[model samples]
Target: MASISFWTTGNSGGSLTVRSTAGLRGLVEAAGFTEVEDAESPAEGRQVSDFAESGPRSMVDLVRGTGAPAVLVSFLDSDVGFVEAVTPGGGTWEALLNRAVADDYGIPLDRFPVEPAVKEALAWAAAAGLTPDEDLLLQALTGSAAFAEELSSLLLVALGLPDPS
Candidate 1:
């Protein structure tokens, strides 16, 4: 069994405790989703901290070092499972991030990073696989015509898909 915990970051507001894998699965179960992973041999060293850094290997290093099977379930871009899971058959990262920002912060994408908002949103969304490409930060700040396209493209390229099949 692999355990996980989620931490949320906010602009000025700081961090919030989200949930642990045990808690998440319990929620999922409560919501009618079955727990699929065996809890007997859970992944070790579960640290539900603030989120990973902004690079490819750094992300892998952080996740792998956590000893989480969710890491294996979360690999993106270079990982074939992520590609195949998210490519044509899955949800969109942009949609998830937009929803998160709108639903959680009451802020639109254009209004993000209103002063350290980037640190919170980027790190938060990126960690959640809701916004993957670090490259999005540049175009988003510019509000360029390419912003939408680049964001979408980055969302497509960088998201980590959940492949249960």
Candidate 2:
């Protein structure tokens, strides 16, 4: 199966500004990742980590630098799955799949509200010339589909991201 964890924000309309290999390099570099490189599948619209080298703090900084809403999906392993969305207005929301693991580890899953993130995604969709239903965004952000990568792919398509395959 094709699967990986990464963050993606919308692209400028009708352009590859933020969804192409070059674009991702630029975005990450702009976000202060000095030694950025294409992900294993650059067409997947993700840049491999400076986050791993620099720490999670770098990832947080990268998202904040976007100045726009962004979504992150992590499904690197069977026992761990996470999704997060951040709005331009500063709202952040997340869902933890693999609840069983979270329970086992005693991790708190609910950290913020979902509605605001959905609203932000809607607003972003409008700005990007895409129109996905609110319920779809809601479900995508919060649903427990069998696989996190599957859900991530669905959300990307719904938000009108180019099919990275």
Per-residue alpha-carbon lDDT of candidate 2 for residues 17-61, written as tens digits (9 for 90 to 100)? 132334455665665444454543423543333222222333345
Candidate 1, residue 37: lDDT = 34
TM-score of each: 0.23, 0.53
Instruction: Estimate the Cα RMSD of every predicted model relative to the unseen true structure.
Output: 15.0, 8.6
- How well does candidate 1 match the true structure in TM-score terms? 0.23
> Per-residue lDDT for 130 in model 2?
59
Best-fitting candidate, scored by lDDT: 2
> What's the count of clashing pairs in each model shown?
3, 0
lDDT of 1 by residue, 88-161 (tens): 11211212222232333333434223334334334544454454444454334333231232332343333322
